[model samples]
Target: MARGRSLSGPLFLLLGLAAGITVGRRWLDVVEVRGGSMAPFLLPGDRLLVEAHSYESRRPRPGELVLAADPRTPGRELIKRVASIDDAASAAELRGDAPDSSTDSREFGAIPLSAIRWRAVFRYWPPQRAGLLGPGH
Candidate 1:
């Protein structure tokens, strides 16, 4: 007895796409912490997993580590701690600022949901520190 089968063009294409999406969503896209902007928690060379999802799925709370687009450097991304927001009360209490305000003082200003690439889910590498890196609070 002999059994043989070959994938057709359409089936092969579909399989390829499914595989691509799975890999892209799970592991293809990743970022590494490069600055002390998010110090005391994340350090340079820390690999982070980035998955494309609804920006509004979860709100960025204070002290949470996030990967955002650097407004000053178009097309570039940065990793920083979410310290404040555009709210007067939140800023004033957490940071102290008025509405329509900016949180981080770096070249980039407030990061709209669109500017956010991904939230730091977990810290990889260095062996010693392997776990979630959410806000201190």
Candidate 2:
């Protein structure tokens, strides 16, 4: 009985840790910025913490940063700000801070809402620019 009790604590801890990791991976993702599209705001190499289930309950709103599948390139993802939402079309227009460097809705037209799965909620890398991503940041 004593030996069983001692093992139970560590076993439970390990199980909990495993469960946490699984849940985290399912709902969260780390994205590394690659271009100057969002420059002056989000620079290259900036790592962002994106929430996969962010749009599960509600449609994305304007001004929010999001990660979406690139329409031009299959299997590729792009991070940009929501420029506008078209409820009638069930699509959203995305734009980067630096228009000159971005290939966004302006080039591809509005993207279907279903294509957008992740919302960029925070910046976690580089230490100095880490914080919640939103207006006035």
Candidate 3:
């Protein structure tokens, strides 16, 4: 009876950990800002917690920060803000906080909404600047 109880505890812990990882992968992701495109609001090296499920239920709104697949580079992603959304067309125009430094909608044109995979919800790294990110930030 003692041996069985000990094994059960570890087994349950392992199962719980596996479940957490699966759920995390499906709904949550962390992305690190890589360039000055989103400067002032999100600088390079800022780590953001992004959620994928939100967009599944509702369309993205203007001014929201999002992680999208770079149209110019396959397999690469870029972080930008939603400048406008066209529900009828299923596309969104994205832009950088610093327009002069960003290669966004201006260069590649509005991207398909399907290309946008995650919405940034919080800045968790660079402790001093960490906080919940919103449309205004």
Candidate 4:
């Protein structure tokens, strides 16, 4: 007969923590604002808690903010508002509040649902700007 040795308590706990962190990263993410494109709303240096799971059930509506992968710059991301959606085409148009200075869907075309990483539900940084983003414009 052979006896099996299971993971020790601390080791198991560490493993669980690692797994949770990985899962949590995929389920939720955090992003920081670095530009003024979304100014007057989201400012430079504002940190936001991104709910990565929010769009798994339904598409974001117009005026709702979302964090999406930048089409022009791979590995980079952008935070923009949902401008329009085409269910038939399975794509969404995104726009920055400042159209004149923004490089958004107008230049990049509609982004696919897969590119939308998260719906920004809360602004958790800067303390002064901490608040829940209310429904649509």
Candidate 5:
């Protein structure tokens, strides 16, 4: 008869490494919905897995929702729809041609691409709701 042995040192180390990688990828690498800035699409507490990429590489589309750092609150993240990019829509807003209740650089100022963390593709959580997020214009 043989007695069960405790976890070996090497096994414990590997387990720890795996856990760390998973946590790092989930928490540090992904973005979580924290406010109603993206309401009707994403709600607070919703989790999104952000892929590692350069924000500058991808041009902001008209209806894509993005995760950007809040200029008013440092270290805080915000999710908002990309009303427009390249200052075209902004210029239009200046001319009073945009939406009446628009949420864009006009209110928060133009944020750099580096501040963006990810482009939300879908919402997954709360069990009742989960699906691809369509363009919101």
Candidate 6:
């Protein structure tokens, strides 16, 4: 009844998987924590699953962890909390959880909306603390 495998079924499945992965990449980003700015909650070397689509889908709010482009450095990324917001400009005043050790809004000023790239939604590393990331501890 069968001398060889049917490739049509397997080919379609592979194609479907590829398409899904491509589309999924657009909504999520994998980032690694590089500093102690977001300490206690997110330490250096911790990996984050960022929700890129959230910034595109909704307005960012206070106390939320957001991935943004460093104002002083081109192409570098920073993760900080929204301590305050400027509704008039639709921008945010970002700060680190450990303010004393952070170079944030106080150093470079509020981050423009365009500089924001994604919202930190989950921590997928260090099995002990793998789950959804809320506003605070």
lDDT of each: 0.53, 0.80, 0.82, 0.78, 0.54, 0.78
- In candidate 2, position 79 carries an lDDT of 88
Indicate the worst ten consecutive residues by lDDT in candidate 2.
Answer: 1-10
C-alpha RMSD of candidate 4: 11.0
- Give the residue spans of candidate 2 off by over 4 A: 1-22, 135-137
4 or 6: which has the higher lDDT?
6
Model 6: per-residue Cα lDDT over 1-137, one tens digit each: 11134655434534543564477877666678998977877899887777777777777889889988998999888899999889899889999999889999999999888778689876657646655678755
Judge candidate 2 at residue 76 and give its lDDT: 90
Maximum-TM-score candidate: 3
Name the runs in model 3 displaced over 4 angstroms. 1-22
Q: What lDDT tens digits, residue by residue, belong to model 3 across residues 1-137?
A: 11235546545634543565478777876678898988898999998778888999888999899999899899999999999998899999999999999999999999999888799987767867766688955
lDDT by residue (1-137, candidate 5, tens digit) is: 01133445434534543564486664224456664545555667886544434354655566766777767878876666765565542311111113353355677677665565566654445535544456663
On a 0 to 100 scale, what is the lDDT of residue 57 in model 5? 67
Query: Between prediction 2 and prediction 5, which has the larger lDDT?
Result: 2
Worst 10 residues of 1 by lDDT: 90-99
The candidate with the higher lDDT, 2 or 6, is 2
Ranking by lDDT: 3, 2, 6, 4, 5, 1
lDDT for position 120 in model 5: 66
Per-residue lDDT of 7 in model 4: 35
lDDT tens per residue, model 2, 1-137: 11225556445634543564478877776779999999888989998767777689999999999888898899998888999999999999999999998999999999999988888876657767655677434
Instruction: Look at candidate 6 and give me any clashing residue pairs.
Output: none
Model 1 root mean square deviation, Cα atoms: 12.0
> What TM-score goes with each of the models?
0.60, 0.81, 0.82, 0.79, 0.59, 0.81
- Number of the top lDDT candidate: 3
Instruction: Residues 38-135, candidate 1: write the lDDT tens digits.
Output: 44566678776555453457556666666666667788676666666665432211221222233354433456654654666555455466444545
Winner of 3 and 6 under TM-score: 3
Pick the winner on TM-score between candidates 3 and 4: 3
